[model samples]
Target: MRYAVSNQPEGATFQVWRGVLAGASASLVGIGLARFAYTPLLPAIIGAHWFPASTAAYLGAANLGGYLVGALSAGALVRHARPATVLRAMMLLATIAFIACAFPVSFAWFFVWRLASGISGGALMVLAAPTILAHVAPSRRGFAGGAIFTGIGLGIAASGTIVPLLLREGLRQTWLGLAAVSLLLTVIAWNGWPAQDAPSSPVNEQPKAKSPPAPALRALFAEYGLNAVGLVPHMIFLVDYVARGLGKGVDAGAQYWVLYGLGAIAGPLLSGHLADRAGFGRALRVALVLQLVAVVLPVIASGAALLMVSSVVVGAFTPGIVPLVLGRVNELLAHHPAAQKRAWRTATTSFAVMQAASAYGLSFLFSHSGGDYRLLFAIGAAALGVAFVVDVVAVARSK
Candidate 1:
C-alpha cells in the first residue's frame, strides 16, 4: 500500500482510501456487531425463555456498564497498547460473546460475556477514529470519518436482515451464525487498519494557550449525558416492544428495525451536509425536535405507517447525534486542541455513565411495571425534551 510521506501531500491515493475502509470495517466490527446485534437478539432470547424481560434488561445494562468501564479506560489503554492490538482483541471477545449467547449458559456467565462484549465495543470506538486520522489524507478526513461511523448503520442493517433469517433456523443457530460472520468481519477489519497507531497528522497534539470556559464544559457534558437517556427506549426495547408487546411477529419487528438502520445510514451523511449550511447548533436543534416528536408519536398514533416514520426518525437521531454534538464541541474548542481533547474525554465519560445508569434504571422499571413499553417511551421522550432545552440554552449562552 502506498503511504503518504512528509513532502508528498499530493501522494494521497487509493492506499489512503483503503486505510479509511479499514477504519470503517473496525466500526462495523465494534458497534454494528457488538452493540446492535443485541437489539435484534433481545426478543429472540426472551422467546426462547432464556430470561424474563426484566432479567433481559439487566443483561443489556451489564453490556453498557462494560462500555462505561471501557470508555473510562480508553485514554490509558491507548497510551499502553497498540490500536491494532486493541481492535483485534476486542473484536475477538465480541465474537466469543455472540457465540456464548447461543449456549444455555447460566445468567451470570452470559452477563460476563455481554459485559466483555461491551468493553470491547467501547474501546474499539475510542480507538477506531484516531487510527483513521493517522492514516487517511487531510482532504479526505471528513469522508473517512463519515465512512467509519456509517459502520454502525451498516451493521444494524446487516443484523436486521441476517438475524431474522437465521432465527428461522433457531435462536441458537442465529447466535452461532452471527458469531461466525463477526469472526470474518473482525479478521477483515484487522487487515484494513494500520499496523501501528503512530499518527502521521497532529490532529489533537497542538498545545493551547488557554482552556475553554467552564460554561462550555457544563453545556457539552450535560447535553451528552442526557442524550443517552433519551435513547434508552429504542435501544433496549424497540424490537421487543413491537414483537412481544404489540403482538407483531418477530419478522415485523425486524422489518421496522431495518428501517431504523436505514435511517441511521442516511442520518449522518444528511445531517452533516445540513450542518454545513445551517451550522451545527442550528442543525442539532432541528434534529432534537425531530427526535422528540418521533419519540412521542408511537404513543399518540396507532397506525403502521406512522410507526415506520417514528422508527426512522428515532434511529436517525441515535447515530446522528454524534456528528452534530462533535461539531458543536469543535466549535467550542477550535483554538485549543489540548482543551478540546480533554473536554471530549470528559464528555465521553459522562455519556457512557449516563447510558449505563439509564439502562439499569429503565430495565428495572420495565420489570416492575410488567413490561409497560408505553411508559418507557414516555420517559424517553421527556428526557429528549430536557436535552433539547439544554441545547437551546447552550446556543443562547454562546451568543
Candidate 2:
C-alpha cells in the first residue's frame, strides 16, 4: 500500500522543510549531544578523576537505561500531550541535563542528569521523524527522513570535533558548551513543528484493520535488535580501540572518531537515497552485508587503511539503519498512521534494550578478557551475520 500525503495550500513546502529541520534538531540534541558526545568525554571524565573508572562506566550506562525507559513511555506521553509539546519539552530537558552535568556534584547527581538526557534522546528518537514525516509528501519522506536523522550524525561529528575543543577548556566548560548548542537548536526548532492538529494521514486514506504485525515486521524487529548488538563494539570501543588498543594515543583516536563522524553524516543520506531507488527491504539487506564486512575488518586486518575503512562503514550504519527500519514500518503499515507510530515505538524499544545489554555485556567481556578488542568485534560481527541470514531467510520464506 502506498502511503498518502495531505493536500496543502501554497507555500506549504517551506513549512514542511521547517518541520524537518525541527525534527533534525531534536535528534541532534537527543542522540547527538545527549548520547554520542559522552563517548569522547568518557576518557576525559575518567582522567579528570571526577569519578572512579567503575563509577564512570556505570554513569555512561545510565543513559542507555534511561533510553529504554523513555522509549517505553513515549507513546503514553504523546497521548497526554501534543507531539510538538512533548518534543519541545524533551529537547529542553536534554539541554538542562547537559548543564546539570557540568557540576558533577555527586555520582548520583551526575547519573540522574545523564539518565535524564538519555530519556530525552529516546523519546526524540521514537517521535521526531514520524511526527515530521507526517507533514511531508510521501514522495519526499525518504530524503526528508534522512535529513531529520542527519542530526544524529551531526551530533557524532560534533563529539569528535567540537567536544575535543571544549575539553581543552575544562570539563565544566565542555558541558556548558554543549548546553549552549542544545539551547540554540531548541529555539530554532521551536516554531518549526506543524500545528498540533495537523492531519495524521491523508484524508482519502482509509484506516486499515488493526492486526498482529506481519512476519516481515517481526523479522525487521529482530534485524534491528541484532544490528544494535552489532554496533556496540564501534559505538563504545572505537575510540579506545584506535587510541589504546592500537597504541595510537588520544589524538590519533580522536582523528579516527572524526572519520567515523564523517561517515555517520553521509550514511543516512546515502542509504535513504538507496531505499528510494531500490526499496527499504533491499536497502536494509545491502546495509547488513556492508556492516558485517566492516565489523570483521579490524579483526582480520589491522592496517591503517583497512582500519579507516572499517570505521567509516560501521559509523555510517550506526544511525543510518534508522531510516531504513522506519521506512519499512511505514511501508508495511501504510494508511495506518496510528499503527505506524506503535510499530516504531516497539522497534525503538527493542533497539534500546539490545544496545544497553550489548554495551554492558561486551564491556564485561573486554575487561575480563584483558581488553581484547578483537574478541568484541568478533562477537559484533557474529551478531550481524545472524541478522543478515535471518533477513534473507525471512524474505525468501515470505515469497
| Candidate 1 overall lDDT versus native | 0.75
Worst 10 residues of 1 by lDDT: 5-14
lDDT per residue, candidate 2, 269-313, as tens digits? 888888888888899999999999999998998899999999999
**What C-alpha lDDT values do all the predictions have?**
0.75, 0.88
What digit string (tens of lDDT, one per residue) describes model 1 on residues 277-356?
A: 67777877888888889888877875799889989988876777766766666567655544544565677678888887
lDDT of 2 at 280: 85
Structural similarity to truth (TM-score) of each candidate: 0.83, 0.93
Look at candidate 2 and tell me the lDDT of residue 180. Answer: 97
| Ten contiguous residues minimizing lDDT sum, candidate 2 | 1-10
Model 1: residues >4 Å from true position, as ranges?
Answer: 1-16, 46-57, 99-105, 133-143, 170-172, 194-210, 240-251, 339-342, 366-373
Clash pairs for candidate 1: none
> TM-score for model 1?
0.83
The candidate maximizing TM-score is 2
